[model samples]
Target chain A: MRFRIRFAQQVVGFFILAALATLVVVLILMGLNQRWFDRGYSFYSRFQSADGLTPGMPIHLRGFEIGKVTSVDLNSNNRVNVVLQIYSEYYDKIKPNSVLELEQGTFGIGGGLNLLPGKNLLPPMEPDSFLPSTDTLLGKNLLAQGLVDQPANNDQMSAILAEVQTTLSGVNLLLNNVNSAIDGTSNNQLTGLLQGVNATLRSLDSVLTESAHGLVPNLSAITANLAKLSAQLQDPKGLIPKLLDPKGSLATILNDNNQLYNEVQSILDQVNQTLVQVRGLTQYLNQSTPQITGVIEDTRTTLKKADDVMTGLANNPLLKGGIPEKKPQNATFHDLRDEDF
Target chain B: MTERKPNLFERVGATTFDLFHNTFYAFGFFWNVLGETFRFRSRSRVSTQVLVMQILFTGVNALFIITLIAVSLGTVIIFYGNQITTLVSTNFVYTILITVITRELGPLLTAFIVMARSGVAIATEISSMVVTHEIEAYLAVGINPISYLVVPRFLGVTLSMVALNLYFNLSGLAASYLVAQFFHPIPANEYFGQLMTQLTPTAVASSVVKSLAFGFVISMVSTLNGFRAQQSTTEIPIIVIRAVGQGFALLIVVNILITLVFPR
Candidate 1:
């Protein structure tokens, strides 16, 4: 039993020693993983803003991370002064005239700082030296002089976002134009004014049907026929052929210039007078009813439908109802002077 | 006038006072033991031998069960905690593992186990010696029974408890990494790197302080209850039971107090 006790004490001793060993091993591993012993060379740069730039952000050279940011502060000039800690192993890449660029993240993704190396073939800068950033005036002059090797921007996400922004702006302008065009009150478009003319014509057509007993039964067909006649006259095979032939009636009339010219001038004068009267009539009708579906380019077809519907309501007295008298809502009178009378 | 029997309020008041008195006495005993621990090297080889035996019984004897329980707990926590906290962050399991096994559960569970195993045995042994006149024999020889008997067990139990808790944390954390393999398939470097990152200094300090406080509480409660034994042999079993119960209560209370006072 005593021998067993002695062996047990040995085991207990080993247990404690082993636990201590584990603790020491873990601490060492942690130190290595967290880079506790690595030497850092310091450099400073300035930026316009501190957005998306923070201490401990990885600084990439070309495409690989070679250092980290140490401190970020605002100088007296209201500019962001960022201090970088480049690892001693990569300190050779940090030559004089090197520049820094702060890349902002797109749509909440993280972005990193990029270091543009010097192109002067100079030696590495010493620690605690000043480095210029792309935002600084000196950095811009260095870039203009080709002293720094600024790589081509290969970020495709920013280009795609810019295209999306431009497309959204064009769509917004189109929507505003469309909104103002069809909003009715402020509209001064060709279709808007022509619609008011159509409304006036419709009222005149209604009144003509109601007053006339045996006039045109379908003004819509008359208007269509008139449009067709004008289109035919403009065709080469129609009026042109007749006028150009020497034996044609038009040619004969043209041969007798004085009488025919006098008659044609009188007809043109009558047509001009008729047009002016129609304009005055249209204006008078527009005052009574204030909307329009005018007999314009596309509305000509709409006016035909309007004439058909208008003729019915105008010619049929039984279908039209008379206006009824409106009764007063507040009929009670509590006036003492009127009651005494 | 006839004296009146104490009412329920007075009975409760007296019991509360007794409980507080016992608590104060136990703390005083802890202070005495701490003072004697410094001078324990001046004691005879018998006390040192007793200390070695105490360590052998408390720490080495309890290793197998502690390892088994730790591995089982670690495996369950990793398998479940990984799946649950994955909704928040993929690396959240490391924080959970460190918190449960190191900062909170590691010290707490080991203290409970040590109290259950060593505490009852210590109380029974000391009380039995008292009933058998062995304590009187030490006193008659001009030897302080405290330095010769109780001090060794006190130091032994406290040291064993702290060592056992550390061993528990090491075994439990290692087991969790192994169990995490079935789920995450992480490299050892990355696994331990992330775990070590989450295991901050505040957490390690919390675990150590709790372990020390609970070790003292368990040893003090058990030895105090043991010395309360009387001449009758029947008092041995009673004091031993009281020692186990008191040790458990004090361990839990001290664990809560340390956790509240310190940051984890």
Candidate 2:
């Protein structure tokens, strides 16, 4: 029985030893990786919400994890303050003006702190330093509003529709007025005017028809008679034929009228000479006929007047006035206005 | 002396004092057992070998199956934890595994397994010893009964527990790798590096401290229960039951302390 108890103790001890050894191995490995003995300064970041951000979240720079979140706590003001344990090796990498941002990305994407290194050549930030984070600008309402806000454009489109509606309505009113005016016309006045013009045209058509109907018969009759006359003239015994015939009257006249022909020839010669002199005289008269006519008419008038005056002097005792007073023919016209004249 | 009727309170107090004294004696008896096991080394090599073999059977060999079971269990935990945190960087994989194994599973599983396997043995053995009057025979021979009977078991159990814990973790890590590769092939470089990085000296120290505490508790509880074993055969089962129960409870407390002292 005592041996049995001894065995039990040994058994328990065995398990304990195994557990200890494993623990030792695991710890040694972890310590080596973490470089547990390395000295480093701490940094601080303040966030509004540190969702699920526990101690030991790694701090990365350019995707390279260089440190870890050592502690997390909320202040009295409800702001989450995180303490980061950065390795001393990267002390110079962090700038004083660097910005710490708590960037929350799309769904299923965990949020993290993004450290943006500033351009200023500031000294390395001291340990336990606090860097302020920029506030999140894309508020919750912005995206939601942007998604659903299209009513304004719809309203503008409706306004154009209304304008088109008014324009169509105005055109409809003008068309209605034109339709009413055409519908209101009387057939009587239109018929009367048409009748009068039709009657006048019918009368003129009657006259033209009468002229055409009668003129054709008359012209046909005249043309028939003229044709008969022309047939007679064209007959072998016609006057033209007889005149042209050598033994006809014209031929006798020509054969028996040599003396007459010579007389006519002499007359023609005189006529030709006279025609030449007449042509010259006509040209001279064309040049000065008005002056010569005026001189002849004046001499006739002066001789008639002198005879009248001697007769008057011989018949009457009244002394003749000295040469008729000279008077202007346009004496009355001189005072008359051009318009009146 | 006159026959006196003691008051109930006085009787109760007396019983309590008696319990306290017995408890102290039980602790001493358990220590003497460990001392005697060491002393047996100088006395005779054959006896020492026998004792060692006994210790090996009870402490090391008996734990083989449990060690294998625990290793696979640890590996399964690691595999699942990795699957869950794949989105998380691989660096955290080892830390999570080490923390869970050492801080919690290692001490707890080891303590419980030993309590069940060895507690009954101790209780029954000591009860039989009482039934046979071997304790008195040892006392009559001028040999310290505790040193000869209990000390070796204490030393054996404690030492074997530490060794077994190491074996369990090693085997568990190996099994974790095999299983992980079968399920999801984690690159050897990344897995090994991550596993190394997460297992820190602080964690190792804490685990060792916890394992030692568990060993001491299990040894003390199981052996003390054995010392108190009476002649009744039923008392053996009763004591074994209590030893196992107390060992588990104590393991939990020690684990919590370890966590508070050294967190991942």
* Range of the 10 consecutive residues with the lowest summed lDDT in candidate 2 chain B: B44-53
Q: B1-264 in candidate 2: lDDT tens per residue?
A: 989999999999999999899878876765666567667656645444444654665565556776677777867787777765655444455656676665567756776777677655766677678767888887898756566656655666666666656666676667777778877787876777766755656766676677667777777777677767667777777777887787788778877877788755
Please give the lDDT score for candidate 1: 0.82
Question: What tens-digit string does per-residue lDDT give for candidate 1 at B1-264?
Answer: 999999999999999999999878877887788788889999889898888888888887888788888898899998998776644445567878888998889998998889899988888888888889999998998988888878988888888877888889888988988988887788987788878756776777888888878877777778888889889988988898878877788778887887888764
Instruction: State the DockQ of every prediction.
Output: 0.17, 0.17
* Model 1 CAPRI quality: incorrect
Model 2: per-residue Cα lDDT over A94-183, one tens digit each:
776655555342332333555555556678788888755544232223323342111232223466798999999999987776555455
Tell me which residue pairs clash in candidate 1: A195-A292, A196-A292, A198-A294
- Return the number of clashes found in candidate 2: 37
- Output the TM-score of candidate 1: 0.54
Candidate 2 is graded, for docking, as incorrect
For model 1, the stretches where C-alpha displacement exceeds 4 angstroms are A38-341, B1-4, B7-20, B84-86, B233-238, B260-264
